[model samples]
Target: MIPGVMEAAVLNKPMDIELKQVPVPGIKEDEALIRVHCIGVCGSDVHYYEHGRIGRYVVEKPIILGHELAGEVVQVGAGVTNVSVGDRVAVEPGVACGRCEYCKSGRYNLCPDVVFMATPPVDGAWAEYVAVRSDFLFQLPDGISFEQGALLEPLSVGMHAMIRGRVNPSDRLLVTGLGPIGLLAIQAAKIYGVTEIYATDIVPFRQDLAIEMGATAVINPAKEDLKERIAELTSGRGVTVIVESSGNGRAIPDALTTVNRGGRVVLVGMPAAKEIPVDINTIIDGEIDVYGLFRYANTYPSAIQALGRSDIDVERVITHKYALKDIQEAVEVARTEKETSIKVMIYPQL
Candidate 1:
């Protein structure tokens, strides 16, 4: 039975999280109402919690802030048929306008009218229940847990990064970050049959997690010379592809020099500076292809299949968990505990 009112971790302003009772959302004919089981605190979520905005997305009012989520379908609109009530599913946060040119060409992630959750103005699934479009939901098989289901959002980012970089068995991959997205990128590269994966991060905890996530070697950029190590690792040939998941300004420029000629670079993380100095000569002379990944498009089904592999365990990155009522602490841990915590998960139903 669904209740008329449910508790939500509402962000009224920067650093203020309150548990307020809000009316359960009404679904459209093509929507489904999910009883949120778990939600993961994303970097953007933490950013909003701290500064009240990410670039152009400003938190102007009270809003629920969590997009990485999975749950059970408690109710469905009359037109919903793909998923029934009681189905366990992962929620894809971006709802695109299906008729846009980008959507028609299978690049829906670039849709101009996308309604991305936890992005300002769109109240997300930090609440006990959320209503979303039915088509954006993917059913989780028996083997996939709700935690893994919630992680599909970040996993899809990695999958899309690999896809954008055109990663393959023959390519050597250099991942410049060991955060949740970077760790998942290493796993995604492994799934693509790329055995030689080198990951870099300043955090020892994340570097160790990188190795655990299937990186061939982990490097601490602060202590070791990244380009020199890459040259040594590849015998001066350099890696065939680079996935830049660390928003650190220096990571991209250093990674560009380590990419082999005619190689690809996928930029997954948003750096602090809107524009950072990059080696244009290196990009031009090396003929490197640079692709900016903005969330994922058309990756849910395949990502779910990939997660079924016995070795692909995404939960390894989840270092912290909390109940929805403790959202302030959850976001605080995620915001301040960068060195210790990787992914902070929340159980709304708790």
Candidate 2:
């Protein structure tokens, strides 16, 4: 073990973070010690830092916040074989009980007995080192930097959403909200061969970038009529698919109203609001298929393979980078709706 404590970004309270020296976590027989290299400043981490909780996961105690991460293995426990000392990898951050029915059925991501990082109570990886489960570590391919590796979490999420929506090459898609997930959704929709993609966002910067990233049309829901624009773009037939990544309370109804009679609607974002009014009558009338996403299962392998192909050009999605010491500033930057940036990565070793 390293004799002394390590520097960490500790959230002792809501809106309070300090650079403190904390003891490194111990590794078990099935775990490994990882020196965190890149930690992405995810919105959930910012939410916990700024608000002290996300939904039911209250920050009852001081917690370190970060989930999107990539690192180098510093030590491997006796039972570990897939990774060794000095291997660069991206940590999946979720450990599920293999004995569960969900795990046995290949739906491990939905396992009730799962310990996911950064979901409040559980301490996350915003530090110099972390003791991670060997099974959660994925080796980074050559030429894919730690920054891109950290991005795999969100990219995998978008890919899962795309898959859930049953995206087809002939489907016309409408994506509501261009936040990081929405931006990735736009890219993923293109990869799904959706010839026409309409993206809606309240921010002009994100709207412009959506166009740059190949959105057939970008509309500001506040400034433009969403239903009309989607209708006009799709020649009045409406979009064949809708990917709601914004988590905005009202987008649910917007999606229900904008999609074609038999279209598919996939929910990727977790809404913060207590509840949003949905047009049940309209959904029944249209016979729209709504799919809910809960993290991802059987996705990492496909995500890594797709990353190797590099045919999707998802690398351009990362818009900002910061050092580990600058994590607070990185959080603020990512919180900004004014900035034109999409994904933000924190390089811990830099």
lDDT top scorer: 1
Candidate 1: list runs displaced more than 4 Å: none
List model 2 lDDT by residue over 267-345, tens digit each.
Answer: 9778777788888988898899999998877666667666665555566777888777887777777776436767778
TM-scores of all predicted structures: 0.98, 0.93
Q: What overall lDDT goes with each candidate model? A: 0.92, 0.82
What value does the lDDT take at residue 266 in candidate 1?
92
RMSD of each: 0.9, 1.9
Candidate 1, 1-350: lDDT as tens digits: 89999999999999888999999999999999999999999999999998999998999999899999999999999999999999999999999999989999999999999999999899998999999999999999998999999999999999999889889999999999888999999888878889999999989899888988899898888899887898888888778999999988887887787788899989988888888888899999999999999999998899899889988889999999999998889999999998999999999989
Write down the worst ten-residue block by lDDT for model 2. Answer: 305-314
* Backbone N/Cα/C clashes per model: 0, 0
